[model samples]
Target: MTSATLHGYLEQSARRSPGTCAAVEASSGRQITYGEIDRLSSRVGDHLRRIGVRPADRVGICLPKSIASLAVLFGILKVGAAYVPVDSLAPPARNAFIFNDCGVRAIFVEASRAENLRYELARLAAEPRLLPLDWSDASSPLATYLARVEPEGGLTVEDESARPGPDSLAYVLYTSGSTGQPKGVMLTHRNGSSYVDWCSEILAPDESDRFSSHAPFHFDLSILDIFVPLKHGATVFLIGEELGKNPTRMASVIAERRLTIWYSTPSVLTLLVEHGSLDARDDHALRFILFAGEVFPVKHLRRLKAVVPRARYLNLYGPTETNVCTYYEIPQTIAEDRSAPFPIGRACSHVKARVIDANGRDVPRGQEGQLAISGAPVMLGYWNMPERTSAAFHVNSSGRWYRTGDVVIEDGDGVYTFRGRRDRMVKRRGYRIELGEIETALYRHPAISEVAAIARSEEAGVSIKVFYASRDGHALSLIDLKRFCAHNLPAYMAPDWFSHQQLLPKTSTDKIDYQHLMRME
Candidate 1:
């Protein structure tokens, strides 16, 4: 109902519902009212100013998903600085690479994540500077850290006087990298706010709604989780860490807290069902179960419907470059559409999507091609790679289209179905990955000869399947391969299934035939 920027939205909410719960970390049983968040974020912003973090200086934040993370994000924006949210669980090298690539002026990290953060920073061949934020206490570690970084409180004259440009970078999110190197996507305030507006309206929940956030803070999905409730005067349930890690604890949370709306990937949902917690004993209060970041398994969707008869099940589709574009809302009272592959649904207002052939021409209805999305939500592109940014961010020959590399087919009904990626992309449990990126990591191993990674979807959701041509033919066991992957890559990016192969399928150009490898599994 509000057509405002993210800052405006939060400012308005704080004005109206000063005492209403703005954010909470269920893991620590801590809460921050909207007014408190406003005050704290501004104070943190003041601290940043005292330390000389000027407008648009990249400030890196690597923290657990909690009240502190949210504060860091808003606080960075308040000073007109852009935030680079690094997933705390990300591999140490990945964190270091992103920080170095973005030229982060300062870094705030949780104490638990400090060991890896420092290791990666030290490993960097370039500037090894790292500003660490220890989050062992305080509502948000950044809040207290900023307090120390700048002793004199109160917003500086420049901080209070400067205005935020609509096109200025709001935040940067580093998603799965195809080159085994994550890419930093710069999102402007307009892009982020427009997406926030679209979601708040489409979901259409008022203050009575309680949205649960299960996605990691760095993921774009978390944007909706953090902003939607604030955009509407509603409460957000930040699931505890133990609950996030252990399925059993989450079950108890659902029954005990009576959460109203839920957002997560299929992997987490499948875990809930597998653990035998998808029963009436759970809170019937969960009114909606929304899935995105990857494809949803219809069978699991069906199973979910059987348990929560009143919940609305929605399939949200979009890449990090753009917020959600298409959504399919299937109320739990209705059975799943298992007959035809579910449509990705229609684009939201200000968003337009088309299926185009290889040359970028529109395909006929019902034909398969790449997806091109045009709208305010189009990302500003990779932070520093101009050539890459130019190739991915395009001005349509017709002058108004940004192409998304997703291969999909458009139906006569104007809906789209995901075919696969035209690039080295893989979506597992709502996370987009680049197999080349994994291969890059594997090649780093002196013991590995050659390797390729791909995603395999199963009843258990999605797991990475890796194939290798080892140098010694020493019977690279799954355990060993996995151990190597864990040592060098993030857990989510690790290949779950390892297979030994003498050679891999190749095309006429001698390139790896990913399609053929997908068939062997």
Candidate 2:
């Protein structure tokens, strides 16, 4: 059972603990044991092979968080292919762009979603084959496909062959691109294996522990949420998208499911503190509270710590390209002092990180600079984007480093603190959104002559505000623009507030003064 690939971890775990719970649906109370997951995923691998899914090919997975999604993920990996997860809540156009951009020839979806994607599939120049897993009708494609395939116990010509190696691509997660398109971040098994290996050492999970899966599959944080638990034979309690938005319900589900490990953005913690009624509540099952994606407000962190005083809190920091390169263990003193932002701590065991100045040399202690990470976990690069990939990384005498567009200040103690972003990307509610992407979507509207989007801190988290100019004599309303954005972008990327302006503020050089707009907020 010794294997190097990501899927092999699951196979090893299943062999070690066949009867242990692998995942559970919080809403439906449905559970999938490790034994069933392995057998079912093997069947999925066989099915995918019959459909000609080749090793190194990309396969799209658009199902919601459930036992089926987990199976489909491992199944895709079992066949030596990577799964491209598109958020089912996102607009079809966005998903279509991802599907085409990644050149995915096949997709696994729910039956209802398959019906909705009929038109989107037709729109694509090279339509991908559909495998709707939720459909139960005997005439359905999934049923028909399964009927032709032999049982798991039966021998398969394709099953005897070797699975993908550690260096092979495991998944391609698409993130908001600055040019109105989404860029797929290509990560290999080596990348994920390093992360999971590091996680096992830091956050120890056993068969008695239960994990809370709050992040969507598209987000990198989900890697730890799904794989770490599976690797250790623990149960993963899935929090659906709807429940995740309602912090009160999410808190209730956590207590009910007895989730021992909680991981999400600070915004979610803020929501739980303000709305979920977590203060003064003693839910001792939550042992590890891991927050990433954004800096948690000191006040909110203080309040959360007061409620879950015994729980160990860790602030994880990194971009999707490198899944949590650094982590800070929030000491209890932070609940009182609250003088500085939590340090991003040192690099993980598998990574080497440095703060470099504009000239690429290491920045002096206590000075601000961009973070450059070099490690096995660093992504392969943006898929099919050689120029951009080359531009994003730098080579030094030591090794190759991925230049994270994030700026930070490193202390003499080697602790890094968050400064700001070098680019237009903003983290809100665990989702990384590019302001330029929103502006580009707005610019496509016929009535919008000019547009600029900015993120402002709100009560719960960050809010997006868009300032737009209308075409001559064409009056624009917030309602209309909201509707337009809803049609094109995901809900998280949509503007929370809109302002119509005849002329946006500009710098002396005639460039849009984003700082002025941010101050106006």
**Best model number under TM-score:** 2
Residue range 1-521, candidate 1, lDDT tens digits = 56335666777889999999887676666888989888878876766676678887888888777787787778888888888887676577878889988888777777777777777777775453355666655555666666666655544777445567778788898875666567998999889888888876767888888788777767788888887888787888787444675676776666666777888876577557655465747456887788886555455566667777777788888888887888877643434334233567777776888777766777888877788888888898888888888787547665556667877777777777776567657677677776655766676555555566787778987777888776575657667677878997887787878888875554221235566788896
lDDT of 2 at 490: 96
> Which candidate number has the best lDDT?
2
lDDT tens string, model 2, 270-354? 6688669665457658899998886565666776888888889999988989989999999875635443457788888899999
In model 2, the clashing pairs are none
Q: List residue ranges in candidate 2 displaced over 4 A.
A: 1-3, 135-156, 159-162, 335-339, 424-521
Count of residue pairs whose backbone atoms collide, per candidate? 3, 0
Model 1 misplacement above 4 A:
1-4, 122-131, 137-155, 159-161, 280-282, 331-340, 424-521
For model 2, what is the C-alpha lDDT against the true structure?
0.81
